[model samples]
Target: MNKGKGRELRAMLRDWRAAAGVYASLQWRCFHQDGRFDPFLDPATQYRKDGAKVRAGIIRQIVLKHELDVPVPEPVKEGEKPKKRVLPTPPGLSDCLAPMKAALGAAQVQMVQGQVIGTLKSFISNRQNDFVDIVLGSTIDDLGRRQLFTINRATAWFDLGRSVKVETVEIPLSARLLARKIMSHILARHKKPSMKRIGMVVDKRVAELEESRSATSHDLWLKVTVKSGDHRSRRIAIPMRSNDYFSSRQGERKKTFQIIEDRETGRITVGVVTDVGSSFEERRMAYASRAQGPKALDFGLVTMFASDDGDLMGREFLRKLKSIDTTISGIARHVQRSGGKPRDSKRYVAHVTRLRGFITTELRRILNRFVAVRKPTTIFLERLNFQSPELSRRMNRILQNCGRGVLRAKLQALNEEFGVESHEVVSAYTSQTCSCCGYVDRRNRKAQAVFACRWCGRSLHADVNAARNIGSERFRSIGSARRVVRSNVLDMLVTQHVQRNTGERGAPADPRMSNPHFAAWADKARLSTKAA
Candidate 1:
């Protein structure tokens, strides 16, 4: 057994040497063509001339000992698939050694590839010392990893350590301290819950949603079936406009609106096409729900964080960045291999940065709008602190570039200047519980955008519901096991039910209408519209 094991280990070592020799020969051939150490063709011809001869002799011995008759794989032609190989392993070697051999070969290939990239970098038109610095920094961190540093794109102006020339206002960190003082004064003045202040925002949101059906474009309406907790079926029509529309690559788009339905229960909202074009009015209304929606604010400043799906601040923006990064990476790889011009890399990066700027700018606008409308004494956001070592580099990059931190910092500065309160919420389960009933159940949220409580049968838009819950967390005893229902919650449920039924009923069969209740509702709606 010892002899067999020894022989196996020897065989693995032999295979590794053979793979390394094969890679070295390929590298040598490329170097030869590039006119490196010319006139010294064979190692034997030059007797100890340089290190190249000695290294070449070692590779030659390995190649000869292996007695390899295998033809070198042909260079892949443009738009052509390379032939796959199924090389048989030596009898004494195990499959475990395959990876080591592949790694050795890969290292050799990269050595040659690095030389090629170095040659290409010299040809860059506007290459500077800063570019060289970025390259060296990346190489020092992980020399084996591929770098996709684009210098030509529109966003190239935001290069690391470079001064950005865009006009911007500077808000001091001391503004937060001022905001805190103002919030403290407000708290001392009013001891109880600020239900009236919250009610104002809530009333506006509900009225807007109610009126939006008629005001919204016919193309923006979506009819979806969602299941109630009581094992009943319900159909709801919502004025839905998708926000996930930032695609970085040409001909590549992410599915922002996905509806996952439960097969047995049929308690899910589905059948919405997110690609439909949204008008200015439609976009304004959709964003208004979150940006200016009613909230149960216990503090002057509210630190809003994500529930289950993702962070509200930069979800769509991150999706856009991801799309752009994928496209840019592909372009970089293609350009790097084919010896393409630097302009191509710059162009792709520029497009991505422009899209990113638009998202961040819009996010700032929304935050500013919220501060202006709400005029809170102070605000606090639910801080996102979760991190795992298992996460991939790609995922980490996405999270970092998604602009959550940037938005948070911007909101702090903007609110500080306004003397509005701002802070962070360290609580959990912001999305699962119902603000009305205090019911905590994962099943309550049937879909990403739909929330239905099992305890109170309260159904509301998921994000709106979450915002309400987040705002009211400090004011209400959410930890209490007993279900607490509110009068306003009852009214909201009734209104939603009436709207859904009336919508299904469509126009009355008679001019007078059969349902007197609906007729009264219609009369009230008409009066409200005229009042507005």
Candidate 2:
């Protein structure tokens, strides 16, 4: 392409991105607002009621009234100067504002609105657990050869092409003045609209796009539009790694996909859903054929994971994590002393990101190794609550917030990959209770690393002993015990120990119960039983 065409293409891409931003902002407003229909109901039924169109119209009215009320430049006539054009005011309306200059097409706008509604439905249906940020990308349909976006294989590279039409429409103002006033009043009562970028959620046809690529290469050339006419397109070759590892594992490509973009980095990512059940099942069976009995995992800050088999993974994980946390804490303290927000400091933000990245990488590596080496049919884990005295309170909070979620997700991925079953055991007194003799006493844990049983003189690493108890049948049996109080659990453990040692169903007087702690727990248990 010539320099002029190259510049023009760059300009068009900017316009496309700007248009997407506008749509995203509109969707954000619609999602936060109370719509006419319930978000919990069927999204299809809501769409049929023109819910998206109505919400879009409302947001457009507000934007035009407040943000884009300026006169737009009209097309220049031959031998004449370009004129400033203003939209004609509709009957019974006071304002004569035009739509946004970088506005998307009606279909695209409706698609954005539908996406907002669908997000709301999902959030509500999922009991509002996970809240995701709105992403920016135009939703494109796959129409085979005529699709807006297509993936074509070339001699040395793959061509990622998009044919886009940039068209603006003069939306008719049909609502009565009184109705307009009511909408303005309602909008004014809500929070001010914030800008967001367009996000894409594609459904069906992505599988066809994936299948179209018969071969894989490490090169990609993107074809985007340079002009605003009907289906104008231009190709730009850019080199990127093929991400072959992920591509190779994609068993059967699915229909749904996502086109995500990072505004800060200007990076575009395309994610395709794939079904790997059959391959995963085959691997699972192979692992199961050679897998040993169940293993319990005790997670810790010093050691990443300590299994019942005395295997301690990522022993230096805490040292590395604490080093990063110390730096972060120092930065935070410095920022606090300067009366500035830690988030506002570039160094602070970088360190925080680094800490998160380290946690993610370490967790992934450690978990993968554990699953591969142990090859346990089932793994038991305590409900994660990571705390450490070696780090600052702030850093500990960060670890819990960031590390816990990542750990859970990694475990889930392991389950999906290897068909390893994972169960959460009650962590209460796992460290204090002796794995060998089932003795429940706080003093049994002599130190952070030592587990010296007071009853049976059993000694081992504290975390390993806890892991063994977590995997024990006795632990599994009392897993359903209600933890209304600390003493209740202690009494149950004492009763189980007595029954096991004496080979009797009733909790008989045992020599171990001569200890003050056990005697007190037994008395409490008797009182609770009498009250019941």
Candidate 3:
């Protein structure tokens, strides 16, 4: 009900925000987007090209303001300029002011220009809702409103000769742009609390993760149960399969081994791991088939363990034996902050000691504890260039940015700390470079891991060699993802030597092995020794 002129309206908004305890500020860009504007690359460009005119204009404005006792608007420069990079245009000024701005726009357009206007008036500490009120209550008439030019959102007020009727101005979403611009500035400069998505180079090939960015909609809920003596009643979901390894019975079982030849290649084939798990399940299904007719044979994932009344504490014992982990992460901010640093104790302190502990501790508890028999001495792993573009495209950007870098970094770092040398180096040519006969032909390396080398009659396992090569390549380009000369993990000759030493234990003693003349002599010597 108390609004006045155009300038008075702007002043009202400013005074309202201040009076209402709002801390919002204004940013203004003096020149709007126009095609025929001088492109300025650096601050020196503005100084070099429009040094005289711009300086003269500033001086003229200052002198005119001095003569007329008014304040002058600040010049537009970058770097030294503040975070806010917006310039406000008064109503109806965009059409008329386009011509005036065009003249100065010739003075080299600084793309990121901004002016900040605070809430307080020149002569009055009290917030005034309109220009009329400020002018009426001030010692200086025009000077009170002239100060509005300090803010980028109010730059048009000064540029249009400081008349103060900026009502109906198109408020650019400059604050949003300013927020993003400031974040970029911080990241580029590597300032405190910076987040940079730079290349995760391991040798020349950068690491990237191509994964399901979204967590899988968990299906197949695991339902645990126990059967002792025969009293089983409740129904539950099928239990999840776990990798179990236990010792077999000592007595010889009905098992046979024989060599077979490939039908096409006439090549000899080796035996495969006995499907004991499948056989055990089959026996169970056979018993069920007798009890429940035809449908009982459809065992699916169901199981019934033979037990005795002596082992009667059934469900409780099984539940105790079966270990499970409760992972807590990626929750809402409120929960994250509320969780706090795991209550400060030896157990809690160890986990809170940074990501190394988190990764290594969890890796052992989750992965290592389950493996049976001989603990893997040389752990075979596919060295995922988690920083690769292929992986980046496949995986979510957040994981592409953090998961690989953090995981790989933590793994290597933990290896040293825990005295565990369990890591591999991946050759850039894992996919292109053939593992068989050391051939580097990209054409033959089709698909993911199936490789048929043209040079040799050797077929290579893509993922296998890639995994082996990952272990193999580690000799040269170890302890560095941040810097590598090129993607080549190592030259071919070095790779061959490393592979031979690792694969065949330095040199071959058996005659049927590799060395030819030695093989002939050794074969003859063996025959002679047998005769003697």
Query: Deviation in angstroms for 425 in model 1?
Result: 1.1
Which tens-of-lDDT digit does each residue in 443-505 have in candidate 1? Answer: 778986688875567887676666566566432333221122333333343454455444223
Question: What is the C-alpha lDDT profile of model 2 across 1-532, one tens digit per residue?
Answer: 3455445444543444454454444444444343222333332343444544454455555554466664422223589753233333334131111132323333333444456556544433322111100000112222321121111111000111222221332112221222233334434554433324544544542112322233356344333223344544433432234477755874786655455554434355556678989888888888888898788999888887899999988889889877888898899999999999888888887777778788899989987888788888888888787778888898888788888789878878778888888887777889898898788888888898998987778999999998998899867765542222355567788778767754312444443445665675556556776788
Question: Would you estimate the TM-scores of all the predictions?
Answer: 0.29, 0.60, 0.25
Q: Which stretches of candidate 2 lie over 4 Å from their true place?
A: 1-199, 203-218, 221-240, 254-256, 261-268, 336-339, 480-487, 500-532
Please write out the lDDT profile of model 3 over residues 341-393, one tens digit for every residue. 43323343232233333323443432233122122333333333323232223
For candidate 2, the lDDT comes to: 0.59
Model 1's C-alpha root-mean-square deviation from the true structure amounts to 30.7
Superposition TM-score, candidate 2 onto the true structure = 0.60
Indicate which candidate wins on lDDT.
2
Ranking of models by lDDT: 2, 1, 3
Segments in model 1 whose C-alpha atoms lie over 4 Å from true places: 1-326, 332-344, 384-399, 474-532
Candidate with more favorable, higher TM-score: 1 or 2 = 2
Please report how far candidate 3 places residue 506 from its true position, in Å: 30
